[model samples]
Target: MPVSRRTFLGGGLAAAAVAVTGTPLLAGCASDKKNSAAVNAAVKLPTYQKYGAIKPDLPGNDAVLDAFLKYPANPVKAITDKPGDGQPISFITNIPGAIPPAADNNQFWQAVNERLGSELQISMASNDEYPDKLATRIAGGDLPDIINIPPTTVQIPGLLKAKAMDLTEQLSGDGVLKYPFLANIPTVYWKGCVFNGAIYGVPVPRGMSRTTLPLYRADLLAAKGIKDPAPKNFEEFLALAQEMTAAKENKWAWTKPPLPYIRQMIGLPNQWKEEGGKFTSFYEAEGSSEALEAGRKMVEAGVVNPDTFSAKASARKQWFNGGIASFDIDSFVAWNQYYADNTAGDAFSVNMLDVPGFDGGQGKPWMGSALNNVTAFSKDSKHSVETLLKIANWMAAPFGTEEYLFRKYGLEGRHYTLNGTDPTPTKTGVVETGIGLQYISDSALALYWAGKPDVPQRQHAIQEKIADRLVYDASYGLYSETLSKDGARLTKQMTDLENEIMSGNKPVSDWAPAVKNWLSSGGEKIRGELQQAFTATSGK
Candidate 1:
């Protein structure tokens, strides 16, 4: 979750005041240049009290916003345009749900076309069928001028070999650096877009928070006489879950989707380190037993609904309508929707809990990619390199600004309204506007974007709270396509195995053999590839 300047000041004013006043003498003493530099460095560093609020020194600029607001009125001429009449630059995407016509209207295209003086057209494929279609298209050498690749389906190595065009030279060109927003993209994120020392695509970073955690009905927890409502670790969390389960007067203790997500909540690594610097399936991790044991404890304690394994998405309807479940784990984005839909005049409240780390185990939480997806240009596209650069430059703006924010979100009066200087729901919901609109096609990176000054201040406050409660694993940055392709398959297998074991179709003893098979079947190779990539790229 991201915050605006107002929210940061409002939330931390008391503490900020205390710090500033308490250190008045220190501030006065820092008159020398060296001392002032030290003071500035300290101020730029993140302080726990300001959790989720990016330090003011963190690079944030209005170039993207400026482009959105001023591009049409004063557009830059292309440094070099292709001679003669240009072909319609074909763009392809497989964003989920329907593509709004406004997104592809000539005015929007014109914003891009003006940068290169080329015709632009967009083609969309069904989201579910995109990967296969893209593969076929690429194999047939009939690629679009630009293609949006979903993170889930990108086979990085194969795509690089067949469809991706190296843009290293263009990315490093003087024109690219002249655009401040494009130039400011963090090198950490840019690393993902590079291969074999060459850049191929512009990375669209995802939000920072990734893992789901248990969100509890605070009112219910209080009613159950649960003291110290927040549990610090797995054992204490289990006890609380059991107590809540036993006291179910009108609600179940917990409910969850019948998926591996629950296992993941207990720190089940989808991929894990094996012997000799190789990777192994999650089942092979020393932590696997702890996760499985945790699962078994939940079932035995009856904290989890017996029907949970069979529960469908709608099974939680009772929980949603009647506040039946005391707690459940879900992605952070769902937290906002849950509160919006479930609140009862402030009687009910939601609190995200940090999924406790294992005992004596290193806490390694998953980190989602900053870019939800990547935008790639086809090798044969007619659009000049300058046009693509302009579009990318325009995309770097923070949401909630006069430019990109409204397009990604929506017009404030129409989609939302301010309530006493706070952005709150108008009749339209978050999905109808704001980050919700982007979720249909994008992964809602606006979660990390600054909020509007007038938006309900509570919205930003709650998001910061959620971010504070999240646990992050820096190792998640180690993911690579070389590992991901094999890793995805292994994860699917592990999920299936867990389901089978829980259903009594397989014995727990099967774990040892499964581990052996996983290691031998390309798992070790994937691990080695990831470790090597991480070491080379991250210097870790």
Candidate 2:
């Protein structure tokens, strides 16, 4: 399959293929028999210890995240000792967009190597290419010292057990306390890191910070004499789309079909919904059918851009950012970037749509797994686990620390300059630090927009408002052999069929047989396996 523009994906295929518009469900991956209750019980997770040096402007807790309006003045060092053993560490992570210049040419990379007192080598791949690239590497046994495991990839559990170093002894229970930064990751993110009854990786925690939402340009709407379009139902929502769109003006309600939002408004489950120990894949839900019809109607009405059915994520974002489109459904992570890109003096205030139900009242948001992905140390790694953990701890330093400032800004005067205590990246900084190092390991996710000071406060408030509303993925932290092995293939087939239906190339009736095929092929097995994982983890 070609790299798609789908920004969001639910596990493999849930919340109506939101992956195209937002992000992967951070979706759970494969599992094995080791998913037994006894195994899970014995494998104690890392202890939770929040890392805080500089208090945030809008303080947050476990549910809501801290938001900083400015970079804390004079960041203190998080790690006093060098973390590396001077052994060169090779890492692999997916760069969301452009692959950064290599270490040979990247001054920031060189500086990091200097600071760590070790040669740090990075191999970066685009998100679109990482799956296949990792597959080939895995097949050839040519793995990096630290490898990022994508959520949508299959057989990850088995692979981790076979090739990834088992970190259970090191990270489980109080052991993780040795690396304070790693321990800062919330317990929820680590739960999914367990597979085959062992902990193989450290989760890159994003938590609710990575959810997808329907966003609109409040300023753009205001320009059109529309103060607010807080539609109360699907009817009003559709009407607002039409109201905001004008073909002659090149304005559209959305650049891509807002099917993910529709799916959420229809009250669809994230990926799987469980009741009485029985699981129903979202693919077979009534809400899925409604989302399909609604999406089809949206496409047919011509309220969205002409490229709605096929544009890449970059194009859609350009459309939204340029005000050619007033609305877009994207991951919350995109919020800060969007503000940064809306540089012109033109009015701009990106706002979230209060997504309403199909009839009226509240809409449900399909919250992704707390984890974005996990990074594992390879069995082939020459460095000890403690050393690797130390290395990762250095990388996992929180935003308000000197390590973070240097890692992000680099050779201060050369790569970046301070703008009111915020690290404003120069052109050099942007190019050099673009290697997706964050994918290797990340501190607990937080809200901070350097140049855009007010963004953190506004975004934090928005997060707090919806803290209780998100419908978390029920399949989260569960193991499913079928889901792990066959999820990508089945999800592709399912989403492709959905696209065809929305594009008017296929009939709505086509959904039934396709669903039947999914069920027989692996969906039913996944259902059973998830229930098994759920029961085992619950000690039921």
RMSD of each: 14.3, 5.4
| Candidate 2 global CA lDDT score | 0.75
The whole-model lDDT of each prediction reads 0.46, 0.75
**Candidate 1 Cα errors over 4 Å, as ranges:** 1-91, 94-130, 136-142, 173-176, 222-228, 246-250, 257-270, 273-281, 310-322, 337-348, 357-364, 420-485, 531-540
lDDT of 1 at 366: 41
The residue-by-residue lDDT of candidate 2 on 141-167, one tens digit each, is: 789899988776565666777788999
The candidate maximizing TM-score is: 2
- The Cα error of candidate 2 at residue 159, in Å, is 0.8
TM-score of each: 0.66, 0.91
Q: Which stretches of candidate 2 lie over 4 Å from their true place?
A: 1-32, 35-38, 343-346
**TM-score between candidate 2 and the true structure:** 0.91
**Tens-digit lDDT string for candidate 1 (121-228):** 556666666766665676567777777755554344345535667666666444346444455444444444543335657665444333455667767777767633
Residue 191 Cα positional deviation in candidate 2, in Å, after optimal superposition: 1.2
